[model samples]
Structures are given as structure tokens and as C-alpha cells.
Target chain A: MNKYIKLMSFLLLIIVTLTGFGLYKAQASSPYPELKVVTTDGKPEYIEPFHFLGFVSDTQNYSNSSTIVFKDGHSRYMEDQTFLERIDFNYNPQLNDFITDHRSFMRGKSRRTEHYTETEQHVIYTGMESDVYWNQPSRGLMTIAVLNKETEEEETFSVSLGSDGSYYEVSATYVNYPNLTILAATNHSTDISEQFVYTFDVENPTEELTETINLTQEIDSNGGVYFGQSFDRTERFIPIQSVRQTDDSEFDYTEEIIGYFAFDTQMQELIDVPLFEEDTLLFADNDKLYVGKDLGDTIELHEMNADDQNLDLVGSIEMATPTIGREEGTHYNNLFNQNITLLDGRLYAYETQYSDDISRPLFQITDIKTQETLFNGTIEPKDMAKHDSTNIDVFEFRLDTLNN
Target chain B: MKKSLHNFLKFTNFELERLSKFLFALMGITFIANLVGYIYTPMKYMGKINEYIAQNSATSEQAIQQYGPFSFYNALNSFWIVGPIALGISGFIFYSFFIWYREWFGKNTFAYRLLMLPIHRMTLFYSKLVVVFIGIFTLISTQMISLFIGYPIVSAIIENTYYVNQSLMEAVQLHPLFLYLFPLDLGFFLTINAVGLVVLLVLFTAILMERSYAVKGIVLGIIYAVVALTLVLLPLFLPDLLNNHYILYGSELIIIEAILLVIVAVLSLFTSRHLINKKITV
Candidate 1:
């Protein structure tokens, strides 16, 4: 009995001692760095810090996305890790069907004059304004319809304009005649709103005038037109396209190719810029467009004039090669996408690497012109152990200015 | 061999009869604790919400809508729900060690009597193991049954309008312990139980070692336990270490874990059988 009491007491002491040691170790090894902010005592500021903005999207699910913008050096040491904005691109098929059905009703009533040209083979339609319809109180839904004058086969595409009118852009591409009406509406509803339609005649351009009157203006001139060009004027325009691969497989994937376009909002004209399919828009500052292309181990950068739309070859930076693995010894390899942002003339590229374990962000920053790397590191969140599965695919990184 | 099998069954029955009162006490205590917690927590919130409504007439509807109803989810947050689980787990852990030590201690010296039985010495070890396993399962089953009884009692106390009622299965998921122990997946539940059995076997072997050689066996038991624990955890970390990077797919990881679980269970049971038959002191 005495031995039993002694054994129990000894075990209790060991447990208590170990627990104390663990707590002490935890207190000593803090995850976050100590922050020291320089405060001004009623003094005037001299130079303002540049703010960076970018977004991260789940490559697996494009709708599960977040937009983050932080000031230089603020986020690196801050305790509150909440993003500036988090957007879940929730796909509402019912809302989309509703918008598509009512789109002709909305667009047919628009007062904007329609422009058309006729060719020997095809009748080309251009500059037909469509009204944006908001069914839900928050999200603005807009559908654009393209009709083949020969077959009368109409194809419609819907764009979700967030509460802010600047969320998405309307773009149409003509491939051939049943294949001719390739109406693509890319949802770039993060920062800019500019619409563009690329039209090409397969044979000879033919003109046939079909009268479609703008009835909303006729019905009530005071009623507002919801779609077309953004109501607010902005200097920057970014057009992003999510290219979907139609290969018959379990993993239906979409890759985003961010394109840069300079729009004269007043003239309603898109400056025709030579955009390569591989080129992804990084950042635009001081009339200069920075674009990046993934070359496996490195990212090739190109500088283009935003005004004249001319491309200049900039140097490339080497990136960390992401380790790829097959799911259950299958042929399909995992998807990896990179997001880039420019701050203080340095380009910050974040690559979200996904595997069986939790997905973590790998970042590398470099000088835009010289292509010299400034810093390369990974941010390990404290709560990484909590998530046991790979659910997150997209992550956006941005920099925003601090309020004085 | 036939006589030994009969003795094993008889000893297991005797152990169960001896443990019946203790098991009942544990269940009764946990049941009362959970019942109080399920009733008290929501009633306290309802009282506070009602008081707020009385003071503020303008926002009464909104306040009632937000906080008036007590739910099974709300009851899950109560100490009674979590406390019983904690108690059961702690008690099981204590009894795992005590189940072996109790035979060596006390006036009768039950270990000597147990060893002197006409059955094989391993039969004695197996009987003790069966008792502990039965005890653990009983506690888990009792907690589950208690939850079903507590659910309706909580619903009756709180108004239906205020509470967002969930089904019994949903309520089980809301509670952390119930979610882990009573998993919807049969394979996952079996896997967890298999791992638990491995742990019990390893512990039993360690105790037998300590009983054999006293102070010298303490060092041996510690080393044995550490090695066993490392072997059990090797599958989780081995692939990454070998490949020089993390690339194991989820399905591959599951397969690795299953293989490791089988290996560990076999090793633990084999070691315990050896220790009981050869090394253990009477």
C-alpha cells in the first residue's frame, strides 16, 4: 500500500513537471515576431508607402477565393491576420438561368444604337448594349447574347457583377458559324470593369440590318441602364480569362490567364494590345504593364507600354520548383498556380503548393526591371495542424497603404 | 487446452461480476452530470435572453430570434456534455494501469492466486484485457444512451421557436467526444478501436516487464514503451523522410496507416503473450 502511494505520488510529480516544462517552452517559442511601429507625435508625413493588391483563388474551385491588400512591412509582423476582402465565388445556376432567360428582355429595351456590318458569308453584329439585371439584392447579374444571323442559333453567357459595378467584364469571341458564336463572359469582378468583343469573319464580311429597338429608353428615359461600361471611371483595366480544359477526366480544371487592356471609358473603345496566351498580367504602374509566364523552374517577365500597347523583353527570375505527386499512384498530377503582385518596384510572386498534407504559400519577391531577387520565404500559419485535408487551392497576395 | 478456454471464460465472468458495481457507479455519475449540464446551460441562456427582452421592447423580437431558444447544439457546449467524456477517458486511463497493479496489491495477493490457476498463465492476462475492453465499451455505450435521454429533456425546457433542433445524429456530430467515438464511418471507428487495442497491449506488456524485474524492469519498460510508440507513429512520417519531400497522396497515406496498424497490433499482442507466459513474476 505504501509502495502504491509512493508510485502514484511520483507519477503525479512527473506529469506536473512535464506539463510545466511544455507550457514554458510554448511561451518562449512565440510564432509571431515582436512589432515596433514608429508613431508620429502630431507631425506631418513626408513620403507615402505604396500599397500592393492581388488575389488568391482555389485552383480546384475558382469560386473559393480571397483578395488581400496590405501596406509594405505591416502584414509581416501583424497579429490580426484577417484579409482585406474574402470572396466566395458562389455559383448560382438558378440565378444564371434566370438572367439568361430575361437577358433578351433587358437588352432589347436598351436605348443604345446597334452597329452591324454585312459580308458575303456572314452578317456581323457589333456594339449591341445589354442591360445588367440584379435579381438578388447584392449580386448584379448580366447576360450577353450573340446570335448567328444565318442559323439564328443564339448562345448566351452570364457575368456576375458584384454589389460593386466594377466586378466583371463582358467579352465575346467569334470562332466560326455554329462554332462561330463563341460568346465568352469572363468574371473578373475583383477591381476593374471593362468589356471587349473580338470579332473575326471566316470568309467575307456581309451586312444585313435587323432592327432591334432600345425599349427601356422608350418606356422610361429616367430608368437606369444596369450593364455595359462601368459607371465609375478608373485608370487601370485588367481582363482575366479562365481557360477550361475539356479533356474527359475526373478533375475538371480551369487555368486563369490574366490579360491587360487599356480602355478609354468615355470613347467605349478597348486599346488593341498584343496579348500572348501564355502571358499573365502581374501589375500595372506608371503606364507600364508587367506580365509573367511560367517556364516550370522560372517565371519570364515582360514589360509592355499600357498607352501604346508595345511589349519589351524584361529579365526572368528563377522560382522554387514545386514538388508534384500523383493521387493514389494515378496518372493525374496535382495542379499548381502562381499569383503575382508589384510593390515598390519589386514583384512579389506567391505560389500555392497543394499535396496530401495542408497546402502552404511559397513567396518570392524580385526587382521588376533588374530581375534580382529581394527575398524568398514561406509564411507558416500557426493553425496549420488544424486542417487535415487539402481543400484550399487559390491564394491572392496584395499590399495596401497604411492610414497616417 | 479445452480446460484453459473454460477457465478463461470463468475468470472473465468473475471479473465482470466484480466490476459491475464500479461500472454502474461510473455510468450513474456521468448520466447525472450530463443531465444537469444539458438542462442548466440552455435554461441559463434562456433566462438571460428573457431578461434582456423585458428591458428592451424595441429589439425584443430580434433578441428572441437570436438567443431565445435552447438547442442540442447549445447543450453540447455545457460542462455536462464534455465533462462526462473527459471523466470517462481519464477513468479508463487510470484503470488500464490499475487493472494490472490491483492483482499485485491488497491482502489476498490476487496475482499469486491468478497465476496458480489450472489454466495457462496467458489466460489470466487475456481475462484482465477482456475486462478492461468491456469496461471502456460500457462507458461509451452509456454516454450514447444518456445523450438520447438528455436531448428531449433539454428540448422540453427550451421553447421550440428559440431552438434550432437537430436530429440525434447531428447532435452526436456537434459534441466532440461523440463525433470521435461514434463516427458515422464504420471503417474509421474500427481503425480507431484497433489502435486503442494496440496501446492497451503495449501497456500490458510494459506492466508485466516491471512486475518481472522490479527497478531494472522500469528502465526496460520505459525503453520498450518509447520504441513501441515510435513504431506506431512511423507510417505517418516515414514517407516524407524517405522521399525528401511531402508528396504522399491521401489514399496512399490511408493504406500506409492501415498496414502500420496491423503490424503494431501483431507486435504488441505477441510481446504481451511472451511477457505473460515467460517473464512475469507470480
Candidate 2:
């Protein structure tokens, strides 16, 4: 019994201490006030059950910062999420089941979400890799891995792009069975970046075709090419934008859109996409691509038809043109700070609306095809008395899509 | 089964008794070192801040601007706070091998006597495993409990104006090294501790292998360790080797890796049991 005393005491100590700590940790509440989006004008059903329009708090300190996700008329903090929910925050559990384990560590495509695609019979992962040697030309290689869903057989293919540059960024991947396509943007030692579409036969590993998407002749001095931000598996066209420096200052140069085009995935060719107006924003939603032009009072949406190489009128969404500068020298109008996104036949515009006295973070969801403003709401603290809007940095408030 | 369970508990207690002195010493070291850290960190910070204020004719705020507010995280990063932690980790790691070796090499060659006891040989293994686990948990609990006691002492020592109020969780969150050791997330905690358990099992198996065989057994033991490690980590590197791609999802990979570790751990236990029962010589 005496011999057991020390062991029993130690065990009891460990169990009690850790249990108390665990309970304390579990019971601890976040100091930040809970915030929820209050829908004033429209139905809450407009915000999808699974889908959420959320803002990551930009509090100066880590302790005060939180992620507020608004869905179904209720707001949830990321910290309050369960273990599975926290895991789901990065990758959907069902999607994660089929997706590659090392997606986060993929070379040059770590930040990209479109590096993997699932076809009817195949699951594919593709990325660009480069090996840089000291005082020598770096070799760029296209890395692709294809898995047959039926047979459960997998094959890896690597295509060399000669000794051009060290850094290659793979933005998106598409699999059309044997034909695997990748969009790679390469940056060279000359401070210039070029985009290319590399097509390879997954069945026959040797054959490769590379098409230069960004033509040097088309790009005038101080001009660079950029692809659209959205990547959809079903979309057959990639939005292309050519920009040139409008202001010539070396450090503080402003870029202006010089050209717009849609690169057809099926045809392997580029078709001119007519811009609705200057400063037009392009977003790809599922199979349809839309161009949005922010007018003072409304944002006009124009659908880009790749077959016709022209623009078709979609619909106009009514929104107040934010004032040019600060409201009474207190709040700056940063309404169009984020890209107006078109997702799943809906248009979402999230902005922190600033006024003379108060700044309200708000979101508007509209049916893109119908142009009907579905839901209009402002994010506010549930306990309004505890809300300190000043502590919220409006500039740092980012509205991110919860999951793709 | 009941007798084995009783014997297992008694053996576990005996194992605890053997390591109790060293465990107590580790706790004492952790306490004194962290206490020194809590005292010295702020005093040195103030000493420098005050000197700067006097030299430059600056306010505390300006000096604080130069050197950030004295947060508990500042003490957390100090050597005094982390040194004993490192020592404790190294101590346990060393003892993991020594715990087995000391019985064979001790004055009377106690391994034969321990084996002769009226109990299943597997009880010896389970008892040692539990003792090591208890020792580690005790150290972890001590560190956490000490932090609860020390944070207020640190705050009291530093001037209220200059000190940054941070909870223990916040301080841990701020320090990446400590966060890895003491993760807030349950998933991470479970995953890390499971990996640690697998490591301890592998180490135990290797020690038993060396004990069972002679000089040539050292090489055999090394091979065994390499094979065990490769088997446990095969799920992680399997896709890369086989297909040159990540075939499994993160959760699937984690699940497979866990299963592989369990398999390897069971194999190690069986192998060690066989060695202790048959192959080991005094």
C-alpha cells in the first residue's frame, strides 16, 4: 500500500490537473463580441444553408481577432467550431476524401484551389515545379498525377519546359480524360512574366503541347497579362486580361486594362471578350462567365459568349455609388474594394459601408440571371450596446467565400 | 486476467517508485528555472527600458514603443523558461533507454530477478510503458500548473502600465514551440501524443532487441528500428514512392498512418514479449 502511494498520488495529480485545465479551456469564452448579419430587406433563405458569407476580423491583436460566418440568419465564430468543423474549414470532408493528401504542400500551387479535378472515371492532380541551381538556368517541369477511379491505377508524368526560369506558378488544372490541361504563369530573371497553357496526354506520357497564351507582340511596353481569379471545373473558358501601366512612375505605377479575351479550353484558342466598359471585372461562375462594370448607381453584368466572341446583357444590380472620398472626413468609401463575385447563379457584393457617424459592414446577394436583389443585410453585434465599430478596421475586413 | 491486472498495477507502482526521485528533481528544476525566468525577464526588460528612458529623456511609452510591452510571451521565449523543458524532454528520452538497460547492468543484474517474478512477462512491458506515460503527463501537468501559479507573480512584479495582459492560452498561442508541445486543439493533441506513444514503443522494442542479443544485436536493433520507423511512416511516404503522387486524402492518410502505427506498436509489443520471455539472458 505504501509502495502504491507515490504512483497513485502522481496519477491523481496528473488526471485532476489536466482535467481542470481541459475544462477551463473548454469553458473559456472569446472576449470579442459576437456579430451576426441582420437581414433588413430580404428573406434569409437567400443565404444558402451550407454557404456562408463571412468576414475575418482584422483586430490589431491575435487574441481579439475572430472569423464571423453568417448563414441562415445566425452568425458563428470560427473559434466556437468543433474539431471536425475546424478541419472542415480548410477542406470539405467529402471532398477531402477524394482529394490528394499533400494538396497544401504542392509546389507553386499551394495557394491555388484548382490544382485538382475529378472527371467521370479519373481523379487528377497537376502542378508546376522548378529546380533552381546557383549561377545556372533553372529547369521548369510540369508535374501531373492521374488516378483511374475504376481500376485504382495511378501514373505520374513530368514534362520539361527547357532551361527558362526557376519560378512557375500553376493557377488551374483541367482533365478531359487523356487530355490534361494546366495554366502556368512563369516569371523570368528579366522581371517579366508570361502565361502558357500546357496540354499533355495522360494515357501517352511522352506527347506534350505548349501554347503561349500571352503573346509578346500583343503585350506593349509595361504591359502584363493576368487570368481571372475564379476557377470552375465545368467552365470551358479562361478569362484573360492584358494590363499596361497607365502611370509611368517606377514604384507607384497604375495599371490599366488594355485588352480582354477568353481562352477556350476545348478549342485551344483565344477569342476576344468584349469589355462592357473600362475597369470591367470578370468572374467565372460554373459554366457561365460574366463581366461586371461598376457604374455610379448600378453594376451592369455582361455575359461573355465564347462562341460568338461577344458580350450579352445579363442584368443590372442596383447599388448606391459610394462617395469618392471620406464621408465628413471620418470614414473612407471603400465599397468596391473587393471583387463582385458571381457564384452558383448568384452575385455577391460585400463591403463595409461608411457614413458620417457609423460604418456598417454589409453584404448584398442578388440573382445574377434575374437581377433581383435577394438579400441585403448589415453585420452587427447581437448585443448592440457592446459593439465598438471603431475597433474594427474596415480596410482589413475581408469577405471570403467560406468553402469552394 | 485479474491476477495479471493486479500484478501489472503493482509493477507499475514499483516502476514509478524507481523513477520518482528523478521525476521530482525535474519538477523542482522546472519550477526554479521558470520562476527565475518570470523574475529576471521583467527586471531585465525594465532595467533596459529605464536606462533608455534616462539616457534619451523619453517617456515609458516611447521606451515601450522601442521595446514592445512586457508580455508573458516574452518570458515564455526566454531560455530560463524553455531550458528546463528541453532538459526534461532529454531526461525522459534518455531514461526511456536507461530504464531497460539499468535493470540488466545494475549492481545485482536485476533483469533476471524481475523476470523470475510470478507474473506474465507482458506485465513488465505494460508496467514500464504506463510509468513512462505517467512521468511525461506529470511533467506536462507540472508545467501547466506552474504557469497558472507563475503568471500572476510575473504580473505583480512588472508595473501594471508596462505589462501586457495575456492569458496562458494566448501566451502559448504566441509561442510556436510551446504550442507544438502543448497544443490547444484536441485533434492535434491526440495526433501528437499518439505519435509519441509509437516512438516510445519503438524505442522500447529496440532496447529489448539489444538486450536479447549481444554485440551483433546492436546492428540488428538498428535495423529493427529503421524497419519499424519505415513501417509506421509508410502511409505518409507510400504514395510518393509507389505513384509519385499523394493518392490519399489528409484524413485518410492520418487514419492509415494511425492504423500502421498501431500495427507496428502491436508487433513491437509481441516481439519484446517474445524477447523478454525467451531470448533475454542475464
Candidate 3:
């Protein structure tokens, strides 16, 4: 019986570990998976569940810097840097959240945040994190798993950053089962003349290579620059986030995640209007897109469509930015972050920013074209939380969505 | 009757003093930690408040005008957890010490057999319980005294702890004795909890004295402990007693504790009386 008990204990340990590892292979993880669990919306082409569902395949290798030994006695992994890694066992058993740094070097002082909300059902695991070297950004990546944990499934898609100092962010997700995983910002840059990059599958080895073109256009000057995800020409110029360098002169570059309330790349693109406070997105009676922005006082709404030819001339609704100031420095600075939303068939816009007393996400909806107030209301910033993305500061302010 | 009463008084005093000695030594550590908290908490709160003002660029005039006095209410609440932690550890340590005492007191050695001389064994039981109660009293008092010295000074460091406005000082002053008194009351119930505990201790002691082997003592101790727990649990788990307690509030824990005590005492009397009467070559 003693021997049997020992054997059963050993088997339980093995099964639990194997179950975790098997799940790991299916969830495409980032360098910091604790950070990655926050994404719920799928990005364009990156799709939902960026794990195993793509066409091409490739493998990269890296060395283990720490002499840490695994319980399995296996000391290495399939050296892909972009694969998101969980902090070495610092994750908690009950909460399934990162609790500490597992690496011996990071003992005592933890550099990672532990608690995160999974807005959608996408899986990501951390692979590793390294200190910034020379002028390079901190090295990390998502280990894209091609299978789903629930379905025992297999997928064909696998891709990686083509250049150094470039990274992908999985930003949003949908709540439904077999949830979609989205990817934002690939390492590849775009040239206007050349539209796509082509590559062939590794196993199947198709005769022809695949093509990818990241098409983006800059629209206005709000100091908050953005990139548009939609291919629809009329809605091409919305803003999401303003990128600021960590250090002006250093050789290193790392993406600092901040909050983005007004950063929507396609929010103002279709309407040719600045997304003022209290602008709303509407589907219209004909199912054409419409948006509103509070210009000065009376709000304006613009009739919008995805058609490229007549995109600019779509008439707009008009509104105003409320001229209210603080009565005793007690009020918050309600400025900067903007939201242009199209819920159902109506368009709305809102503004929320930061102050000492109050710093959170809140916005309004207005007319699409004229920056006019169709109506004004505040939606909790967390409510309008972007799909599948953790750092709303980078892509959240820019990505466009039809509110579900 | 008078002789038995006299013997009980002597037995209870001796045992209670020994328990106090152990508990008093433990409180020496509690007092030091509490003193450290009193000095350290104010300094830490001031540091956080200073950082907040400096980073946000605020002045003293602005702070007083904007909020109120410098009172670290949140920081004050942080140190309050120490009292409970100290009390809990002390309680466990005290219980373990008593278990050891029970074992040592039962052997056919100089101490155990001496106490059994011309004594109603009930006197010995009351002595052990009084000792436990004394130890609990000393430990609880040390914890409360420490927190009383710390909370006010820490609260004063925040802009407005509002505790002062809410009559916190007066409340603390009027009820300082209750701080030690409440836990001491729980300690009484806790000491009473040891009735079955004493039986297991005595049973382990008896078996160990007879058997010269190490396994007998440990194995017997474990078995006795388990049996004691089950017996003590009977009244709590009995369908009728449970119904009275849970549904009707018609029964009291003392009644349950008394029944268990009586059974253990009866068994202990018979075994000890037989063991004393039987001739054993020491």
C-alpha cells in the first residue's frame, strides 16, 4: 500500500504537469504571458487565437541564460524569442495568475504585475523576458501555439517578427467559445508601392509563397498619432494611440503600455471630423455608418459609408465641447482621450482624461461627420475596453470596432 | 473535605506559576515587537505622505487647507494586524506546552505520583486548568498594551485620520482593559477546551510508563489524541444536541463539555487508582 501510494502520488504529479504542458502548446504565449492574458479582441489578419491557425511555419532558437534545471531534467525549449513565456512558476495554482518571478535572479524584487482580467477567451503563455541589451528594447515574443486547449485542435498558421526591435501585441477578444485572438503591430514595416509579404508553408512546402501588405495612412494632427486596421478606404484615418519613446537619446526602444481613451485610428476616418466629447457611432437606417462629435455647442452628425469615392462629402451632424471649468480644483480634467463609437445604428463620441483626484476611462458619443452632439452620455472606460488587447494605450486608442 | 480543599489550593498555585513562567517569557518578545511598531509606523507614514506631496507638488498650507491635519489612518490600520498574529501564535504554543506538561505530570516519577498522594484526583485537574488560564492572561495583556501605544501616534501623521474627530481616543481610553479582557475570556473557553485534551495526555502518559519501547509512547499518544478528539466531537455532532444548538439555541457548550469531562474523569480515576494500588517494580 505504501508503494502504491507513492506511485499514485507520482502519477498525479505527472498527469497535472502533462496537462499544463499540453495546454501550453495550444495557447500561443508572449514573452510575458501574465501580461498577455488580458487580450480579448482579435486584430486584423492576426485573427483570434493567434496560436496554431495560420499558413506558414518556422522555428527559431535561443539559449537559456540561467542555469535553472527543470523538474523534467529538460533544460531547453524550441528557441523562439517571440513566444510569450510565463514567469518561471511564479504563477499561482488557484488563481492561475502570475504571483512572482520564478527565476532565481529575480528573487525578492518582482518586476511584473500579477493580476489581470481575461476579457475574452484567448490563451497566451510567457516564454521568457530579458533585460534590454545595447540599444535594443527588452527582448520578448509570443510563443504562438497553433492548437486550441478545449478542442484538441490543430491549425496551420505560424509567423514571427521579420526584424529585430519589432513586436506583436494581441489586443482584443470576443467572449464566445473558440474565441478569436487578434494581433496588432507586426515587426514588418510598409512601403506604399509594395503592399504584401509572401511566404510558403514549411511542411506542405507549396510552390508559391504567401503575401502580406500592411496598408496604413496618417490622417490628422491631434498629437495622438494612430494606425488604422480596416481596409475600408473611407474609414481609413481614425487614431488609436500616440507613441512616445522611452528615452530620446538611448539606443534602446521598448513599448511602454499606457491608457488610450480617444485613440481610434478609424474613429474619425469615415466622418472627416475630430472626435470631440460626446460623439456617437450609428449604423443608420440604410446600415451605412454614422458618427457625431461635439464641435462647440450644438452637436453635428455625419452620414458615413465605407465607399471610397463619396467618403469625404458625407454631410456631418454638429455639437460642442462643454465650456465647463473646475469650481475649486475639485473637478477632474475631462480632456484628451476620446471615443467615437457606433452602437447598433447610432454613432456617439466622448472624452476622458486624467487629473490628480480622478484618472480613469470615460467618454461620450456624438455625430459622425459634423462633430455634432446627437446625444451625450458616459460609458465606463472598462466597459468600452478594447477586444483581445492588454495595453489599451498602444492600439486601443486607434483600433476601430462595430460595438457588439 | 478541608484537607482535600487545602491540597487543591496548593496544587493549583504551583501549576499556575509554572505556566506563567513560560508565558511571561514569550510576552518579552511580543513587547519588543510592539515597541518597534510604535516607533516604525509613524516614520513610514511620514515617508509616504512626504513622497505624495513632493511628487504631486503640494505645500503644507495647501495640504492643511485642502484636507486637514497629517494623520496616517491607512498606515495605522496596517500595524493592527500584528496583534492578532501574535495572539494566535501564543495560543498554539501555550496549548502545546500544556500537552507536554500533562505527559510529564502523569509518569510514575517524583512529580506525578507525589500529586496523587491522598488527593482527590479532581484537585489535580483544576490545578492544570488554572495554570492554563494564567498563561493565557499574561499573553493577551502583552499584545493589547503594545497596540494601545502604537495606534494614536500613527494616526496623527495622516492629513486627517478622522479617527480623532470620531472619538477614537476616548474609546481606546475607556476600553483599554477590555482589549486584554476579551481575549482572556476566549482563553477561558480555550482552557476549558482542554478537558478531553487532558484525558489524551494522561492516557499517553500511562501507556508510556508501562511500555519501555519508544514506539509505544508515540503510537499511543497519537491514538489517544484521535480518540479524545472524537469523544469531544460527539456532543457537537449528536443529531439531537446539534439540533438544540443550531436550531433552538436550547443547549450550551458548557453542558456538552461537562459530559465529556465526566466520562474522561471517571475512566482516568479508575485507571490511576488501579495503577497506584497494583504493585509495580520501578
User: DockQ of all candidates, in order?
Assistant: 0.01, 0.21, 0.01
Model 1: runs farther than 4 Å from truth? A1-404, B58-60, B65-69
Candidate with top lDDT is 2
The parts of candidate 2 lying over 4 Å away from their true place are A31-35, A38-240, A244-256, A261-338, A341-347, A350-404, B47-57, B177-183, B242-246
How would the candidate models be sorted by TM-score, starting from the highest?
Answer: 2, 1, 3
Q: Alpha carbon lDDT of residue A317, candidate 2?
A: 74
TM, every model: 0.45, 0.70, 0.34
lDDT by residue for model 2 (A1-404), tens: 77689988999999898888888777765545676557766765564432343444423244445555544456566666765545545422223333334343332232234566665566677765432112234456666777777677777777776555566666666665677667765656446766667777776777344655554334443566666644234456666667675656766766666776666777877776666544566766665667767665677778877677567888887753342211222111211123345657877665556554455666677787787778776666666664443233233222223322
What's the count of clashing pairs in each model shown?
24, 0, 140
lDDT of 2 by residue, B1-282 (tens): 788888999999999999999999999999999889988988998899989999999998898789877778788889998998899899999989878888978578998899898789889898899899899989988888888877887788788778876676667655666555664777778888988998898888888878888887788889988998888777776654544333444566677788988888888888888888899888
Instruction: Tell me how far the alpha carbon of residue B244 in candidate 3 is from the true structure, in angstroms, after superposition.
Output: 50
Ranking by lDDT: 2, 1, 3
DockQ-based CAPRI category assigned to the predicted complex of candidate 3: incorrect
